[model samples]
Target: MSEIKKIHMGPAKCAVDLGDGSERGEYVNQDYILNKLGRPHRAVSLMYCYYPLDETWPARARNAFKDKEITFQWDYPYDDYFTYKGGIGGTTDDEPFTCMRDVRRHGQDVILTMTIDPNVTDEHLEQIGKELSTFGRMQLRINHEATGNWFSFTKRATYQQVADFYIHAREVIKKFAPNVQTILCIGGVEHPEKGGEIEMEKEFADAVRATDIWSVDKYMALHWGWPFDVADEGGNSFGRSKVADTYNLTKLSEKRYRELCGGVKKPMVMSEFNADGDVTGPYEQAEMVKEFCDMLKNDKDQGWFNGFTFYQFRDRGRLGLEIEDPNNADCGIEQPVMQTYKEIIHDEYFYPEMKSEGDAQFPVKLRWGGSEDAEGIEIPLHFEKNPTFCEITFEDEDADLNLMMEINGKWFYKAPHAKTIDFMSAFFEKPLESEADMTLKIFAPPASGENVNDGSEDWMLNTYSTITKMPNIRIRFAPILK
Candidate 1:
């Protein structure tokens, strides 16, 4: 079998849920994401099964990303009332089959998470294993905690039972998706009843031993109507000042899991994470995102972390999605947090220019309309081809005295002994010609040191200036003395 590829650091993308029932519209379309962010995301998670609600789920997903490049992770039906009720008789058999067919047909990739509920019997899991073996591209989702009607073996059953379930799941996953791309384990939820207070570190560690990829989810109470400050309590704080919550949680979880795996050679995906309480403004939200990214980028050790996927692309009503305040028009589209994120993601810088060995100089005359007190001034300077010393001499000494030479953006005074004054000794590289219309701004600054402190004094500095599309500009290189 070919080796499984590992993902390191990169941009944090997003995963969106395309609602349920007839009202289920495209929650977050690919085009919308691309346009808003400028580039296609690395991965996107699709919630819900493709059975009845979305018979054409694969087609819709494919069309949404027809010409773009993205990784699509399908969250197969959870062992729950919503999925089981909508699916054909709550059977796991046809679900995997249909999902695989869709994956193959649509030419899309998927991270298939198997059910870990008690209702799913050993026989059912075996079937899932067989199907995974048949399916080419897939990932397994392991549950560290119970969900929906599912009960955790860690709670009621013995440790052996928990280990058995994981061993079986692993064997089956290897039989089919043997590359074992991803493994997502449940972290914790807001509510306490759903396997509340149960720590499955040992259980998760055992599972990771048999898989190549690993991840976890921290369903914060903030999304479910809890106060923002509540996160601050119990080491979970969503406050603007406590922006490290998301990063700390994910990092801590991954660190433990890596330790459990004896070295953490796998990437940690924040399977699910979203903001809660008083929907943060764009700028605040952007900072929160930056916190998550900056921590990963700055982490000196460990190479298993790939990237993060924002729990959602848009706000889902069930999650109590709230705008800061409608009347607070300032919180709208130009939200500070959103703008901040946009800037961070689209930041561009000029490429550095390569410095050559020998010195080079090129000089040319420049002219422009005079402003305020300045008038037409002539500047004559002989630049050394590669010499370490040179100076300028103008035919009209009076005109030259009334003018000054500006190199780059700094101004220099004219000396009586032009030949004695070495110009090349000051410059690091050969000076090039300034572009046209570039203002040298040959004026005078208010005298302060060594001169009278009045604007009436004449500095008489003729500044040569020009503007060009080139990266650097200089005027001392022209009129090379051969």
Candidate 2:
């Protein structure tokens, strides 16, 4: 007998991502999610390149990303390209907002991120505040990774200067957008000595007061092509070629955050995270995904921690879950990490919106029959009444468990195929006619050759008998009583 372990399904949490928005029609595919995966993400994140605030730039941003569903907008407007009124004005690669009309119409909230300039004028801050006031709410993040040397703000602006700017921006935005919140995004504590040796409290004394949420950006880059030290960039450490041996990236980040920014007790999130495919293959990346989620759930400060935003949806330079192919816009090849991520976020913990409110429980038992070699079982859903909503939760020891439902003489296979499944739900517009006739089957994970899609159900036809152990399962149903 194997040890019975319970998978803790935590409370509702936010799970977000940055999808591909390279072109108009080249956005992330919804058809694949609806028809294939049968799920929708909680929120979507978009990226906007550097652009100074010209009169027309806001209109371009509004036109490009007017979708009310966008939860976060990443931007890179720096001191070099920005001024009080307007600097070098042209079209940015992408913009978060173009006009305030769409924002007013939808009353939608935006998670806006951008770098602050040391030379920014009060007029510039006022313009930004005024623009944000027209929206439902805003989470404005200024000068992310101020401790990192990549951005000009790190070198040009002192910590006090950055903090002063942050406080000023918050005050200006609050006057107009009362519902707006400010976020203080920092690079991970791992490289705290990157830009300077100053402590966060003394340096960011004023900025901490203005911040509503705290965020950090971390990545698994030790074993990647990156050298241990920035001074050794041209060294032979380029081909470390192995996935990181440690699974405590999240744990380390949280610990370091508490050590450095412990005084500021605010909500924290991993604003950006990923294991580069260029650094590690899909399998290793998939492993890291699970590890990171586990650490977030078990180790981090749950009260102060919210959730994370994955860097990219499709493979873009070194990051992304799905393989990027410009020719195939629908959805590129599913990297192993893609399916792994889909399954992990499918948990109700990530999508609290899907959590059911009903208290009905439908007893189900796996009926094992036939010869001792039988690989499948007929699970009978002994429902006393018709159900308006039904969901099944089960824990499989291996990835070999496959589930199917027979409705109206047709069979539907639950997706995230061949992967270990945690739970699945079914909702009917109308009450079920007869619960006795409805049946479900479980079989060994299918083992078909690659590129063997015949466009028919013949591929799913399997008849092997190897009954080993009874799977741990739970069922819940909300029935409509006439």
Candidate 3:
């Protein structure tokens, strides 16, 4: 059992925003898609309003869970259905880009979002990297909620042009979709931690320089435990980590996006959230789904939290898709929050129980992708919810090459190319923790000649960050060419 891998935070990567007040009918209703595959967090989300009709939304997100281990979260529209009726090499009509090429040929994992045009430029981000350069692996989130005030391009893009278009659309997906893992999503509620959130956390740490994960889209209407202080430490519902919302908007934008990731702990996702505990009482959405799953199974913060999606999922017995808006009343599944989220998504702590042994250092801080630019990828490792022995290094120094890291076997090395992204990782000295098995690996090479993207630092590529934001699905290899 002491081979070197064991980590656990149990069950944290959950999702379900199929549709709330469906003006679209929860993607062609099949009982609103089996009430999201009837449970145990199979991950499901979609939204692609490019108009011109035909938003099958990746075949209704592969009809919920037909992809077996599905994990889809897609949202589109920065207005450019391939040049909205003709432009970037005009063509007219629509295709929704072949439904994102049939949602990557029968979807399995995704988290791509968009909505904030500010009349996007840079040649419409090189045609959004030629339409997201062959979606092999994704998690874009393009300029979403930049700093709030609701899009009109958030007051005309200027959070430094919305973090310089999130580092120029992740360097144009490293020249035509280097496996798209770009992220910089903000707006997790009115944001707070000091007036104007310390200058919007210094304009999101001076207009992005690195990213792949740092999401937020908070929500809370009738949350919990903080009536001034009757023993108020967020009032024990399960144990500690209290959660009560109305304005805390996902804990002040996840504590000001971890102070703008200065300490670079990358790997945090609440991508979009929800809460209503029945607007004050009445089974309060099943006690706000058991106090938001017991404050996310007792969060410890800085554990590099990953995925907690739950925006909408059928605002009621649809049966005519109800919508008179009372904050979408208990927002979704209804009736004691759908039987208390089917018994807290079949608890095991939500996902725990993969343990192997002990050492306790654990801080892989969730997965992140590759290519600072030079075209060389093979990203998509795991462990953000479970599995952690923590000790990761990578401050970027060109981030070297030929670095393959299998969960327990395949280990290839060659980082001496000098550049520094820092490395010191741990999840139990060096092996599985809580969760990470399908053999996670990382391999990169391709950047040469003038030493490619020598920006010197800024590499939190945390191996394309995704410590299980769903039922487990990792991908992104197709760059190591020349």
Q: Indicate which candidate wins on TM-score.
A: 2
lDDT of 3 by residue, 286-366 (tens): 565477667766766535455565555554321212322355543343344555655565565543223333332222223
Question: Which scores greater on lDDT, model 1 or model 3?
Answer: 3
lDDT of 3: 0.41
Candidate 1 per-residue lDDT over residues 322-346, each given as its tens digit? 2323454222122343344444444
* Candidate 2 weakest lDDT stretch, 10 residues: 365-374
Best by lDDT, which number? 2
lDDT of 2 by residue, 93-141 (tens): 2234431111111111245556655565666666666555433334666
lDDT of 3 at 346: 50
Report the CA-based lDDT of candidate 1 relative to the real structure.
0.37
- lDDT-based ranking: 2, 3, 1
Better of 1 and 2 by TM-score: 2
